[model samples]
Target: METIIVENIYKYYPAATKKERNKALNGISFTVKNGEIFGLIGPDGAGKTSLFHILTTLLLADGGRATVDGFDVVKDYKQIRKRVGYMPGRFSLYQDLTVEENLQFFATAFETTVEKNLDLIHEIYIQLEPFKKRRAGKLSGGMKQKLALCCALIHKPSVLFLDEPTTGVDPVSRKEFWQMLKSLQLQGITTIVSTPYMDEANLCDRIGLLQNGSLLGIDTPENLTRNFGKPLFALKAEQMYPLLLHMRAYDQTATCYGFGDYHHITFIDPHIQQADIRSYLQGVGFTEPVEIRQIAPGIEDCFMDLLNH
Candidate 1:
């Protein structure tokens, strides 16, 4: 079953001079299935946050319509709020309140108690229990994130929306948090998470790649990477910086970008031989043992390919 449906959603922010409005979201559309973890993957200012606010009914879209669990975002906002849980990009809990107090408050707001929904958040709650008396503002970054997540889930919501949940947290905490989400999925709760990290795209059941308030593509990570229909190679030399410039200047290079330790390149002519590239690099003053080999496209590669086209 489709748990959430967004159709041609559009949102705009007025500028001071009124010459041009900031198009936060432009005709964006996608659907989330029940019991699935759907991801909106993009960099900052890509309209991921704006789209989240619209679906959560915190902000209204100027055009188009969205329904969460069959309740329209505008007409049935009250019903949607009751059924869905939202964790904004910012930590929004009462900072002065203790960890336990914050959780209790959110539970009360939902007309429920912590104990009533304890089973729903046991894995996460146990981590926060030791710091139950600690003021939310005094907790560490990872702790604050866990506490926020606990509060959002205290209501046993059927659908959950998490916006940039791991943006500033430590890597270990990010891994743990995603594990918690995976556990939540087993309970049949649909989740929608927006993230700027390209690596996290593979964690979701499916992802929508958004850029400049537009969706570039939507599909499973494996399929999206597979669709990047070009022979890709990774090259590296003793002088990494100089190799990048040389690769870009090459006649056969289609796309060349620095990726970690290696410079990833795609050939404009697929029939070009690797031996030819080696010879070219050697002629360009690169010594022997210059590394160049075929490599598969990753999620970032696919995203860049989409952006380039």
Candidate 2:
């Protein structure tokens, strides 16, 4: 069942000059299935947050339509709000309130009680129990994240929207947060999450790559990488930046971008081999050893490829 449907959504913001409007979302469209974890993967200002606001009914789109849990985002916003739980990118909980108080506050606002939906947030709330008395402002980043999530789920919402829930969180906390999302799936809650981290894309059932207010592509992580239709190679040298510049200037180079410890390059000619690149680099000023090897494309590689095209 489709829990969410967004069709040709468009949004615009007034530009600084006031003579032009900046398009925040450009005919974006996608769907989310019941009990599915859908990820909006993109960098900052890529329309992820704007699209989230539209779906959550916090902001209206300039054009097009969207429905959450079969309720129209515009006309039926009240119904949608009741059925969905939203955690904005930033921590919006009361800083002066303790963890317990925040949770109770959200529950009461939803016309529900923490005890009434204890089972819904029990797994997550347990982690925050020790800090129940701690003021939200005094808690750690991870603890604050947990508290926010607990409050969002305290009302037993059928659909959850999390906007960059782990942006400033620690690595350990990020891993734990994804695990908690998986747990929510087992309870039959549909989740829509947005994140700038490419690594987290693999954790979702499927992802939509958005850039410059446009959707680059949408598919499973494995399929996105597998469909990258070019031979890719990772190259490393003693001088990384110089190697990158040299590689980009190479005649056979199709796409060359710096990855973590190495630069990933694709060739215009599929027949080109690693030895050929190594030989070319050696013939140039790169007298030192150059490590070049064929490597599998990852989600970031796929996203970059889409952006380039």
Candidate 3:
């Protein structure tokens, strides 16, 4: 079953004096299968949040249509809200309220007490229970994150939509959070997550790469990297900064993007061998220069290549 189906969805924000609205989603269309972890991978201002708002029934798209769990997002918003659990990209829980208060409020709003959904959120809720008396605003980034999620799950939703849920979370919390998600999936709840982190893309069953309100491609992490169809090499030297400048000078350097610890390069000319580049680096007295070898492309590499293509 398709848990979410969006077709040619277009959302625009019109300037008050202008004749046309700025487009947020450019006729985007995709379907997420039931019981699968689907991802909307993109950077900030990439229309990811806009699309999430549309599907979660918070905003209206100027054109096009979307349905969640067989209910039209526009026409069946009431039902959709009831069946879906949404955690917005930004922290939106009651700031002044204690952790327990926030959870109690949402539980009462849904007319289902926390005890009613205890089985649904036990694993995550227990972690938050320790800080139940703490003000939501006073909690750490990750604890607040867990509380927000617990509230969302109190209703035992059929589908979960999390927008950048781990954005400011600590590494330990992020790992713990993903584990909670995996546990939720075991209960048959479909999960849709949106993130700007390329590393997180691999955790999903499939990911749609979005940029500037456009989806560049959709595939599993391994498949996306495997089909990159370009040779990539990693180069390192004592004078790393200067080495990149020299490498870029070569006409054969198709793409050269820094990857923190090292820089990745792509060859436009197949005839330019790795050994030739190695010898050139040596001639510049680049020390042992470590090593340069053909390397497998990762999610980030594929994303960059897709943008260029």
Candidate 4:
């Protein structure tokens, strides 16, 4: 079953003058399947949050239509709110309230109680139990994250919308959070998570790569990377900074960017060999420790490829 459906949606923010309005969403269309974890992947200002607000019925689209669990987003907002959970990009909880207080407040607002939904949030709730009495404002970033998620799920929502849920969270907390989403999927909850981190895109069943309020592509991470249709390589050398500059300056270098410990590159001339890149680096006075070998394209690589051309 399709839990969410969006078609030709468009949204714009009016500027000082009518001629220069900021277009936040342009011809956006996609669907989320029941029990599927779909990811909207892109950098900031890619329309992820805008699209989220429209689907959740907090904002109206200038054009087109959407439905949540088969209800019209515009006319059935009240019903949608009752059945869906939303965690905005920013922490909007009552800072002065204790963690437990915040959870209870949200449950009450949903016409439910935390105790009634404990089974749905047991794993995350247990982690926040120790900090139950702590003021939400005083909790660490990770703790605040957990408390917010617990409150969002207090009503046992059928669909959850998480906007950058892992932002500003520790590595361990981020990993735990994704695992929690996976568990929710097992219970037949549909999840739509948006993140700017390319690495996180791989965790979703499928991802939509958005840029400048437009979707570049949508597919499974493995399939997208495999279909990039290019020979990619990772190059590392003694003077990493200088190596980067020289490699980018190389005539045949199509794309070059620093990625973790190595500089990843793609070739403009498909016929170019690995040995040719090695010799070029050597001639440019690079140290002997220089290494260049073929590597598989990652999501980030594919994103850059899409953005570049």
User: Would you estimate the TM-scores of all the predictions?
Assistant: 0.98, 0.97, 0.94, 0.96
lDDT of 2 by residue, 1-309 (tens): 999999999999999897888999999999999999999999999999999898888899999999999999999999988898999998999999999899889999999999999998899888889989999999999988988999888888899999999997778989999999999999999999999999999999999999999999999999999999888999898899999999999999999999999999999999897788888888787877888888999999999999998
Candidate 2: clashing pairs of residues: none
Off by over 4 Å in 3: 15-21, 279-290
Q: Where is model 4 more than 4 Å wrong at Cα?
A: 16-19
Q: List the residue pairs that clash in candidate 3.
A: none
Q: Weakest 10 consecutive residues, lDDT, candidate 3? A: 282-291
Error of 3 at 138 (Å): 1.6
Give model 1's TM-score versus the native structure.
0.98
TM-score of 4: 0.96
Q: What digit string (tens of lDDT, one per residue) describes model 3 on residues 1-309?
A: 899999999877865668766778988999999999999999888899999999999999988999999999999999999999999988999999999999899999888998889999899888888888999999988888888899889898988999999996777878888899899989999999998888889889999999877889988888999998878999876777888887787666888988777789998776678777877666666556566878899999999998897
Q: What RMSD does model 4 have?
A: 1.4
Model 3 clash count equals 0
Expressed as tens digits, the lDDT of each residue in 1-309 for candidate 1 is: 899999999999986677899999999989999999999999998999999999989999999999999999999999999999999999999999999999999999999999999999999989889999999999999999999888999998999999999997777888999999999999999999999888889999999999989999999999999999889999978788989998899998999999999999999898778899999888888775787789999999999999998
Q: How high is the CA lDDT of each candidate model? A: 0.93, 0.93, 0.88, 0.91
